[model samples]
Target: MFYRYGRGDEPDLQPTKNWIRRVLLYGAYLDGTRYYYSPDVFLFFFSRLLEENPDSDIHQDTVPLPREHIQKRINADGDAMELAIRILACYSLGIRHKIDLTKQLSLQQEDGGWEIGYLCRTGKTGSRLVNRGYTIALAVNAVGALLTTRALSRNGILIDEGFVESNA
Candidate 1:
């Protein structure tokens, strides 16, 4: 996509914040894991970015300006879930990139969240911490992770008591 639209000044089509988050999530999970083509390159660059920009905000009123001098590396067949998780992690840890890469992998509300895709693929094997299935077990896990991170980064509560209190 970048190559066809590789103009140096081309404007990004989607929200920049989400892209930043997804790229970092992809990098973290790609690390130490074998990919179809080769190892993911962002593992190193993002590591350095995290190392150098430790003060980046996890939650605030404004998005942080990205540094102009980021290094690019090439790799193929990267893990998508890793990318989703890392975006969440960066958002939690304070990179503040806005793209919910998970949303891309997840089934749309129109699809009822049951169909299969890379997002539906299981990461678990041989008694891993996470499970492997398209069952509610998996869906709940993913939603739980997203909600947990979101709560941690902002509201700090899973369920809003105000809504429950008002209903009662």
Candidate 2:
């Protein structure tokens, strides 16, 4: 809290801040308890970014690690949920660096819904990610956020904070 409110960016603190900041910020993942591959994990992080100042210099380096999980790890129906989470995370962080939505949107089914992505692995067992409404609703919300971001950008508006907070 002192760092957040005080002049922590002063020259006196720069060296210590740089060295210890990553250890502190990523400590949760380093503990070997938090699985970065989980959508719920990333969603929790994204939720925190909701209140972040757009101009704050928060390190977003760890953010893209989840994308690799979506790309290489998730092959089952879990893609929809995980991919949406990745999108939401990027949106919240205001990264906006050539974010390609095609890969995610392509997962939409012919019935205009999303398959039930793995909520969590039960362990050592494969389960068919059933087509369900919960996943579909989340997908819809994610897509809506993406579309709003695009439209805002086209109109010369920057979602520097995020779609939800920026639009509000």
Candidate 3:
């Protein structure tokens, strides 16, 4: 949805803004701290939307996630994919902090892919682990986010120069 909007396509802004607000409001809590899933990805979209529509009512202040909260998560060894997302979010939001991009790079599997595991914690029940696929897709997004944020250099990942173009 955000990617489409970022590409200059028109998406209904109201619902997208509302949904982003809701996600920030009712997101998951880890280690007694709240975090939205795929935060960097969402931040990229949200920030792009705000940039494209400056007169829109949606403001960065309206976003519930704080820089400190995100920083704490980054410090806590959160999930690899989520961390990548957070890195992009931080970059988009102009929050500066040291994040070891190598950690995310190191998780790649021997087949040049990444695996996603579920940390399922149903209300009050103990968490269960489940391995899932579509790993290539997730890995691509993760890598893209890293590249977009410049966390990984050209030597680290072979990114096409035209992969992301500036709107300006």
Candidate 4:
């Protein structure tokens, strides 16, 4: 029961936009992630820092989940990588201040590493990429970013506010 997610199956990823976004977004380095999606952030970080929740515009329930199912480690229901991206995005964007980081934290394996279920289908062969090392690195990085953000808020460095409801 192999799913062939050829280039046609995947949304037209600009050369490799989705992959790039997935990595940065999932890594929780949102300042860097913003640059990938919109460059204006480079010049004006504060303006883009407080943007309308990305979730407000794009609802996960509406977007059809990718059919390119390979092997999942934690949740068998949805895309693991996508879940990471969503959680990190909400936290980093200051869009969902109440977003529970524990949502992603709960998926941690006994080994204390996260497994990336599905990264993205390769444009040429459509082979989904899920690297154990890569997953662990990014997941740890995302968690670090989240913790750091919370610390900043506690220190009164960042305003703790959210524009939308929790996606976690």
Best by TM-score: 2
- Compared with the true structure, what per-residue lDDT tens digits does model 4 show for residues 41-134? 2212221222322232121321221111111111223333444554444444433332434555777889897776554445666566567776
Encode model 2's per-residue lDDT on 9-116: one tens digit a residue. Answer: 467766754544453345433322223445444443534433353334433434444333323322223377766655555555443432334556788889888767
Q: How large is the C-alpha RMSD of every model relative to the true structure?
A: 15.2, 9.0, 8.7, 13.8
Candidate 3 regions exceeding 4 Å error are: 1-60, 63-65, 95-98, 119-121, 124-131, 134-136, 148-168
Q: Which candidate is the best by lDDT?
A: 2
Off by over 4 Å in 4: 1-79, 97-100, 163-168
lDDT tens per residue, model 3, 16-101: 66675665555433322232233443454555555455444565446335444455555446555555555555554555344434
- Estimate every model's Cα lDDT from 0 to 1: 0.35, 0.51, 0.49, 0.42
Clash totals, every prediction = 10, 0, 1, 0
lDDT of 3 at 88: 53
Candidate 4, which ten residues in sequence have the lowest lDDT sum?
65-74
> How do these models rank on TM-score, best leading?
2, 3, 4, 1
Among all windows of 10 consecutive residues in model 3, the one with the lowest summed lDDT is: 28-37
Candidate 2 achieves a global lDDT of: 0.51
Give candidate 1 misplaced runs (Cα > 4 Å): 1-34, 37-83, 88-96, 105-111, 119-143, 151-168
> What's each prediction's TM-score?
0.27, 0.50, 0.46, 0.45
Q: Score candidate 3 by TM-score against the native.
A: 0.46
